[model samples]
Target: MKFLRDILDKVKPNFEKDGKLHFLHSTFDAIETFMFVPNHTTKRGAHIRDGIDLKRTMFIVIIALVPCLLFGMWNVGALHYAAQNIDSTLLENMLYGAMKVVPIIVVSYLTGLGIEFAFCQVNGHPVNEGFLVSGMLIPLIVPADIPLWMVIVATAFAVIIGKEVFGGTGMNILNPALTARVFLYIAYPVEMAGEIWVSGIKEGLVDAASGATALGVLGGKDLEAASNYSVNVMDAFMGFIPGSIGETSVLMCLIGAAILIVTGIGSWRIMLATVIGALGMGLILNAVGGNPYYDLPAYQHLLIGGFAFGAVFMATDPVSAAHTTTGKWIYGILIGVLTVLIRVFNPAYPEGIMFAILFMNVMAPLVDNYVVKANIKRRLNRVKA
Candidate 1:
C-alpha cells in the first residue's frame, strides 16, 4: 500500500506551479474551464480571454445552419418521394436526401480545406476556422444536380479570389460561399440556370417527375399575359417551391433565423429590416398600377427564391455586413429592396440573392464610414454644447 501510494505521488501532475493536471483533474479542467471559460496564461497584449475561440465561433455558425441543412435534405427526399407518387415517410425521405447531399458536402469540405491549408502554410498564419463554416455553406447554396468538378473549381475561385486575395478570413469583404455561387452562375450558365431539375432514384413503383420552379417558370413567361402565372403563396412558405437546394423553404429559414437570433450569432435588425424593405418595395410596385415584371404579390416575393436565405444568413454575416446598429438596418433594407428589384426588373437572372449580397458587401465599407462620421459629428456637437 505504501509503495502504491509512492508510485501515485510520483505520477501526479503539479497543478500549482505550472497549472498542469493529470487524469480526473485534466478532465474536469477541460469541461469546466476550457469549454466554458479557459484560464490560459496570456503572453500577448491581452491578458484575459473568453471561452469563445475561433473553433467555438465556427461551431456556433454550424449550429445555426443545422436547420437549413436538415430541412434541405428532408425536402429533397420528400420532393423525390412526391415525384415518384409514393407515400412520404419523414425518416426514409431524409435518409434518401442524405445520400445525395452528403457527397456535395464531402466534396466541398475537401476542396475548400485543401486550399485553406495551403494558404495557411504559405502565409505563415494559423489555419482559419472560417472555412469550417464556409465549406458547409457552399454545398447548401448549390443545386442538388451541380457537377462535382464545378464545385471544386468554384470552391477554389471563392477561396483564392474572394478570400485569400483580400488578405484572408476576417478581411474578406464578400461572403466566400456567395462568391462560389456567383462564379458558378457566370461560368456555367447552362448548369446553374433556373430551368434545370434533378431526377432522383426510384423506389418500388414511385416514379419521379421533372418540373421547373415557380420562380423559373414566372421568369420564363410574362406574368401579365399568362393567367396561370400566379404561384401558391403557401407552398412557397412551406418550401415546396422549386429553387436552390436549401433555399426553397421559407418556414425552415425562419426557424434558422430564430436560432441565430436566440443564440445572438445573427443580427435581428438585418433580418427584420430586409423583410420590411422587400414588403415595402413590393407594396410600392403594386401601387403604381403594378410593374408587369413584378406581378407577384408582396408576400409571395418574400417567400419565393433565395430572399429568405439571404436575409437571414448572407446579409447578417458579421465580417461582410455593416457593423453599426443603424448601418445594419440600412444595409439590410437595401439588400431586400435590391433583391426584389433585380427579380422584377432583371430578365437575365431569376434569383437575386447573390447579386444583392455582393452589392451590399462592396457598400459595407462606405456605410461604416458614414456611420463613423455621424458618430464623430455627434460627439463634436456634444463637446461644443
Candidate 2:
C-alpha cells in the first residue's frame, strides 16, 4: 500500500495546477482518492470531520447490493436452462449468467464514469462519487437482454441531463439510475419490455413461449384466469420468477435492506411507511374487489415486481428522498399507494415501482415543506404557551 501511495505521490505533480498534464487532474485525483482517504482537513470553520466520506458511503451501498447481483446472475442462467429442460450444474449456470450480466455492468460504469469525469475536468470541479452507486444500479434494474448500445446511451443521458445539468450528485432531484431506466423504458419500450427480461432464451433450445412476467400475468386478467400464468408465491419470494436482474428476488432485497439499515445509511421510517401504505391500499382494493388483481393478497404485492428493490435501494436514496422525518413517511406511503394504483389500473405497464419512486422524488420537496411548516408552527405555539 505504501509503495502504491509513493508512486501516486510521485506522479501527482504532473497532474497538479501548473503541470504539463494539468488537464487530467480530475482523473488522477479520482484514482488517488479512491485508493486512500484524503488527508486534507478543515482548518477554520466548524465542521464535523469523520472517516465516512462519500466514497465510503457509496461503497457500502455497493456492498449491500452484492447479494442481489450474485443471485440475479444465478437466476438468469437458471431460468435459461430451465426453459430448455437442460439440466446443468449451479456453477455452470452462474458462469453463463456472469458472461451476460458482467458486460452490461462494465459498459454502464465505463460510460457513466466517462461522462462524469469529462464534466468534472471541463468544469474544473472535483469528481463526485455519486456515479459509483448509479452505475451499478442502472444494470441491475434493466432487463438482462437489453442492448449494450441502449445502456450506453441511457447512462450518458442520466449523467448529463438527469445529474450534471442539475449540478450533479446532491443537487439532483431525480435518482440518476432511475432517470436512465425511465428514459430507456419510455424511449425504447420495445427493447426495455416484453419477453426480453430473461437472457439465454434466444439459443433456440426451448420452444417459443409467452415471456410475460409474474406481475404481467396477474395484471393481464382476473384472479381465476390469471392463475394459469401465475407463479407460486414461494417461487416469487425465492426469486424463481422472471423479471429484472436484481428485482425478482424478494429474499435478496430483504438481505440488502438489512445491510443498509444496519449500516444506518437507509431510512427505516420510510421502509416501514411504504409497507404500511401498500398493505393499507391492498386491503382497500381487496374489499372493493372490482378487479381480480385487487383480490390478490396484500403481502404478495411486496414479493412481486420491483417493489422491494425500489423500496430498499431506489426510494431510499438520501439525495432524492424526503429529508424531514414526517416527510419520509408521507413520501414513502405515497410511493406505495401510487405503485399499487398504477400497477392495478394501468394494465399496459404491469410494474409501477419505478414510476412511483420517480414521481415521489419530484414531490418530496413539497412533502418536506409541509412538514417543516408544521414543525415551525408547533414551535411557535409552544413558545407562546
Candidate 3:
C-alpha cells in the first residue's frame, strides 16, 4: 500500500493545476479517490466523519446486488436452452449465461461511465460515483437480449437527460437506472417486450409461444378472466420464470434486501411498508374478485414481476426516496398500491414497479413536505398549551 501510495504521489502533481497533464485532472482525481480515501477534509465544525462515504455506500449496494447478478446470469443460460429444447450441462448453462449477460454489462458500464467521465471533464468536476451502481442496474432491469446499441442509447439518455439535466447524482429527481429502462421500454416496445427476455426468441431462432412473463399471462385481455393462471407461482418465487435478468428470482432479491438492511444502508421501514401495502392491495382485489388475475394469492404479487426488486432496490434509493420516517412509510405504501393497481388495471403494460417507483420519486418530496408540516403543527399545539 505504501509503495503504491508513493507511486501515486510521484505522478499526482502532473495532474494538478498548471501541470503538463492538467487536462486529465478530473480523470486522475477520480481514480485516486476510488483507489484510496481522499485526504481532503473540512477544517471547520461539521458532523464527525467515518470510513463510510458515497463510494463506500454505493459499493455496499453493489455487494448486495451480487446474488441477483450471479443468479440472473445462470437463469439466462438455463432459459436459452430450455427455449430451444436442447440438453445442456450446468457449466454449459453458466457459460452461455455469461456470454449473453457480460456484454450487456460491459456496454452499460462503458457507455454510462464514458458519458459521466466526459461530463466531469467538460465541467471540471469530479466524476460522480453514482453510475457505479446505475450501470449495473440498467443491465439487470432490461432483457438479456437487449441490443448493445439500445443499451448505449439508453445509457446516454439516462446519464444526460435523466440525471445530468437535473444536476448530477444526488440532485437527480428520478433513479437513473429506471430512467434508462423506461426510455428503452417506451421507445422500443417490441424490443423491450417479453419475447426478447429469452435469448433466441427475439431473433426468431426459437419459438416465442411460451416466452410470456407471469404478468403477461395474468394481465392478458384475451383470457377467460375466471381461468386459473397457468404459471407456477413457486417457479416465479424461485426465479426460474422468464422475465428481466435480475428480477426473476424473489429469493435473490431477498438476499440483496437482507444485505442492505443488515448494513443499515437500506430502509427496513420502507421495505416492510411496501410489502404490507402490496398485500393489502392484493387482498382488496381478491375480495372484489371479478377476475382470475385478481384471484391470484395476495402474497404472490411480491414474488412476481419486478415488485420485490423495486421494493428492495428502487424504493430504497436514498436520494430519491422520502427521507423523513413518516414520509418513507407513505412513499413506500403508495409505491406498492400503485404497482398492484397498475398491474391489475393498466391495459398497456403488465409490470408496474418501474412506473410506480418513478412516480413516487417525483412525489417523495411532496410527501416529506406534508409530513414535516404535520409534525410542525403538532409541535405548535403543544407549545401553545
- Candidate of highest lDDT: 3
Model 3 regions lying over 4 Å from their true place: 1-7, 44-47
Give lDDT tens digits, candidate 1, residues 1-385: 5775465446445433354553234333322332333445767685666676777777887887888899888888887778767888999889878987899999999998888767766665656577888898888888876778999999999999999999888999999999999999999997787445443422233232245766676666556543476677788888875556788888888888888888788899999999988998888777764445455678888888888988888888889999999899899899889888888778788887679889998998899899989999999999999
Error of 2 at 197 (Å): 2.2
Name model 2 segments beyond 4 Å from true: 221-224, 227-229
Superior by lDDT: candidate 2 or candidate 3: 3
Instruction: Give residue 293's error in model 2 in angstroms.
Output: 0.6
Q: List per-prediction Cα lDDT, in the order shown.
A: 0.79, 0.88, 0.89
Q: Which ten residues in a row have the lowest lDDT in candidate 3?
A: 222-231
Report RMSD (Å) for each prediction in the order shown.
6.6, 1.6, 1.6
Tell me how candidate 3 scores on lDDT. 0.89
* TM-score: model 1 vs. ground truth: 0.85
By lDDT, rank the candidates, best first: 3, 2, 1
Candidate 2 versus truth, CA RMSD in Å, comes to 1.6
